[model samples]
Target: MAITIKHHIPGRVRFSLAVLKQYRDLEDWIKQSLIAIQGIKQVRVNSHAGSIAIEYDAQILTEETIKQRVAALDFEQGEAKETEHQYTRGDVAMNAIGTLAAVLLPSRWGAMTTATLIAPTLIEGVNELKDKRLSVEVLDAIAVGLSAWRGDYSTAMMTQSLISFGEYMEQRTSRNSDQLLAELMQPAETMVWKLNDNQSVQVHSSSLIEGDLIELKPGDAIPIDGTIIKGAALINQSALTGENVPVRREEDAVIYSGTSVHEGNILVRVDKVGSEATTAKIAQLIYDSLSSKSEIQQVTQDMANRRVKITLGIGAAVFALTQDVNRLASVFLVDYSCALKLSTPVTFKSIMYRAAQNGILLKGGSAIEKLGQIDTCVFDKTGTLTYGDMQVTDVVPLDGTNDARGLLAIAASVEEHSNHPLSQAIVNAAQDNQLPHIAHGEVEYIIAHGLKSTLNQHCLNMGSRHFLEEHENVDFSPFEAEIKALEQQGRHLIFIAHQKRLIGMIGLRDQLREDVVDTLSQLRASGIKQLIMISGDSQYKAQMLGDELALDKVYAQATPESKSRIIEQLKQAGHKVMFVGDGVNDAPALTQADVGIAMQNGTELARQAADVVLLKDQLYAVAEARTLANIAMKLINSNIKLTEYINSGIMLAAALGWLTPATSALLHNGTTIGILARSLAAKHAK
Candidate 1:
């Protein structure tokens, strides 16, 4: 089906109403199909809007070509429905009745009737043989064929009925799971207030078109991508940017779909609508992450494939040597392919769902497996361990001005232009005290140091002790004892200097997360042997925090590059490290670690670079993620082992002639389904 091109850019195309319910595994199937196309870079399906977005090289795949290919593509939902119909209650009942009828009827007539009823299985088996594929269908066909030829019509009918039931159950289970995932992917619909001139109209979000003006009130979700045309509000963009806090948005600010307006009012001029929104792109990225297979999955698949081929060869060889059709059927039916292939994906995807519910988005199965193996965890101290919510605890005037508000007002004026957390904190504290903005001349911001500006025609410098005392040669001896005392309490200090002389200091305390200590203890208990912290704070402050957390190592006054080097060094020393951070500065270290976990409220750079993201902004999520990972790995390994053992027993029983081909097929199918059910039914730990 050709989908409507809702929006198009040089490398991206958003297709509306593109998803079909008939495709049971829509996300993965669409991804696999489109990703193989010559120029296609990626594909994301939004099941909620029934739309898909594709990023591709336009030079190779033209818009016309994409449309034609999409229209021509076929998915197997119809085929699955047909299969489901064949195994419905009515079919099962008829099959059971036929088996009974065949047993009670005359010998020749019963055999002939049974043969006719089991013809589809024989045909499928012949097709498998022609395709050079080993399949359980062939084994079922052989068992039914041999029994009918031997005039054991009851055995043929009963075996075919049982095999049909098992296949139905397996397919039904998988189909139901696919439906659940699709439902979860479905986006929730909401009403958007569109502004046509001075009038407001309430309409569905999907009905919104480009160039339309929309008004967002307090507690309203921004349903379309747009730029603010008027008014201002505190917008929560956590869903889009992984930021746990809401940001103030005013005129000219870009607002995205799925983010909400927390306060005030705003008029947004829509630029992107429907599937073209940023939320849709994120959904696509997430789908791509989860659908991609891990190395373990590929290895398991290879092993299963090899085993199937070997089993088929063994069956053929045994049949040629002994001329035993029943034995050959038994060997073919007892192979381990189904259990291995079905269980692994169920386990992986199920865990993905569980993690999503608990506020973690695992990039893929590989991340889950890698997380389980993490032995050392490195944390960025500022925004990661602490709440990143800095507050003005104490303000001291060194020049005996006794004007805390005046000092804060001066500091806020110099720091208001910075996007740094600490800078914002100072500005916020000043705002809380209702200090009016002071006029300041052009400001010079020194990277990772301080900002120098002309306030009241005097050279005003505001920053760290190093920036004031060492860099600017400002005297801090008068407040050295107070600085030492505050540093010991893990409070961050920002000094204010006027006319090249220290005048005041602001003591900001970034409180640790409520759950950090407990979560750290949990991680240690869960096999995280080494806990390390890296911070840009002074040695005294970093040491204080490290001591409080009881970390294994602390690297204070570390630069961004040094943080990455520390991760590399730990990795070189034979430790699987997971780095957690929340700022853009931590991006390098995050990438360098074995697994990078970005906080939900972290910068976009950190979120994009990290392998996993914590959506709840909770430090305890680290422990939760680790626990889930360990559980997933354990479940996968145990399921594989159990399947192998069960299949082995079936093979042995069949070879010894202690179990009939029919009975062996039932047992094998039962084992496979049982394992899959357990994988799907696993309860997630809190």
Candidate 2:
């Protein structure tokens, strides 16, 4: 279906409406001149630009004929919304009356479409500013004025409102343009792209600055790639990168050019211009990232059938009511969007600011809300639940000659140059007690194991069993039984020997988080009943930690993709899941979960992977955010219900004619004002 778009509103119509609305007495003059003008849909006499575009049916009217008539007509512009006529030759009110008295003249019907406005010009002389609150009042007064004349106020008001609203939009558009121009300007490049069928599409325009509108529809490349201005377009931004879900282009959401709008229409506003918006550049970042579908998170692929019914029902309801064009247009004013669009986004923005102020940065409000609903908390064992630092949990000496501290000091001296966590832990332990630690010469880290070096001239070795036994002169016989027993008990052992002679063993294990036990109990008590632990560690280690923390499940030796798959499995079972990790490997699972939590102390890559970043290094922050989001959502729903209850009563009374237009306007508009005030009050509410 083709959509009708009016290019712009006329300048004269804007100026005239401005003056006439300011001076009330000039209303008669407008009525007299417009009444006799037959077949005219709009009577606009702009005072500033003095230019107007007359719109009428081509079946009964021609553009040229109407233009000639409009040129011949004479009308005055005055204010009507506020301020009395004070400089009308000592009889300002009388002059205003005379001005409006002329509008009482007989007229023919003419359809006039308004023109685009220059905001700074229009507002220069506007008497009073009317936001959403006062706009309802002005509309109500106009409605009452028409109904009292025993007239069809709906049609008349709709026509005037359409023109007036168009003018108002033009003002906003101009202001937006001005603001954009002030920031940056990129002249539009007229590039003709060759299509598959030898058909070339040309982009021809003026300034192609950032934040300019780009129109797109189904099966179209969201023109110039931008944040969404309108429509819930499901976009395939994949050509620009690897993402599992299609990004939905709606208000506050973004989309890019070369991305196909699969099913819905879109109006995208450019955010980045020129080289920065190159499709290739966007595609590279998207593809280059080792991002994959977090196999762990589930999908809603089966919900299409249920959605089909609701979609049809909603479309039918909207169509049936649109038959009456005036009432259909009225929906734009009393849109369900007032709360959903205005209040909700504003609330999200405010909530984000609050989070930021508390040393947390939530990517967006959607993340916060999603995070609050997480029922299952999945954590990566290393760097997350575990400190990733391996400590000397046990030290078994062979022949009772090598002491734990002496063996560790020797091992740490050999492994001092190593970057491994276990090696650092040994060094830290020695340093903590102020042990006189000194490297006994050069060292080499054996790949897949520990270090090899000459400590005090005996060619010492500190590594796995196989690595230590490789030394030609060392005898593994003495410590063989002891090492085997420790390895059997699932202890990570680093064998230390001097030229094949058994010296001592340093056994290290990853330590758990200090608050892991407390936090796990709290999560279970907080309705997150299903807790899971995933780790790159051995099954024995994972089970040990899981049993200690009382986790419901534990998966060991799982890669990032495997972790994501586990999340998907749980999600498929209809459980809302949350994944927490602090590594480059955890990005997929982080993106996969219903919510992803990034610890502030995590890697930069991991920070970008997770949805919610925990500040203050506490799990309780996650709990607090969930509670806060619950509060925000509860307040939002309550506000919506209240608005509906109040507005329904007012409009229902108006429809019944139990309240005349004036009283109805007062009641309806008064309610709108009250609701606006109430919405603002939420900013201060708990």
Q: Give the per-residue Cα lDDT of candidate 1 at 228.
A: 97
The worst-scoring run of ten residues by lDDT in candidate 1 lies at 77-86
RMSD of each: 9.8, 19.9
lDDT for each residue of candidate 2 in 1-686, tens digit (9 for 90 to 100): 11112233322122222332333444323322332233334433333333333333345444444444433434343223321221212232332333233234222211111111112222322322343222322332333233323333333333233323323332333222222221111112333222223332335422356755655543343436467766676666554465645666578686654455544545556786543353342223221221111111112112222332332344245438545323322322232222222344344444544554454555545665665577888988766786756676776667566677777777776665554456767777777766666558655555334576786676777776656666434577766677667655666677777766778887777766777777777676666878899976567767877887888899986866788899899999998998887654576798888888876555433554566776566555665566556655565556556656765565444333354443443444344444444444443455
Global Cα lDDT for candidate 1: 0.75
Best-performing candidate as measured by lDDT: 1
lDDT of 1 at 497: 89
Q: After superposition, how far is residue 142 of candidate 1 from its true place, in Å?
A: 7.0
* lDDT of candidate 1 over 1-686, digit per residue (tens): 64788998888888776456445445555654455454566666655566778877777667666666666556653122112122555555666777887879888778767877788888987987899876555565666677777676777777777666655554444444333333333233566667876766767887878999987664455767899999878876765566645799889989887676655667899997654454433444444565568877887787787777767787778778878878877776676876777677777767777877787777778888899999999999887899887888988888876489989898897787554678879999998989988888866656567688897798989988777877889987777798888777777888888889888889999878999999999999999999999988988778878998899999988877899999999999999999999875677788889899988777654665677888787999989889888988899999989988999888877776677766876787678778877777653444
Evaluate residue 603 in candidate 1 and report its C-alpha lDDT on the 0 to 100 scale.
60
Backbone clashes in model 1: 4
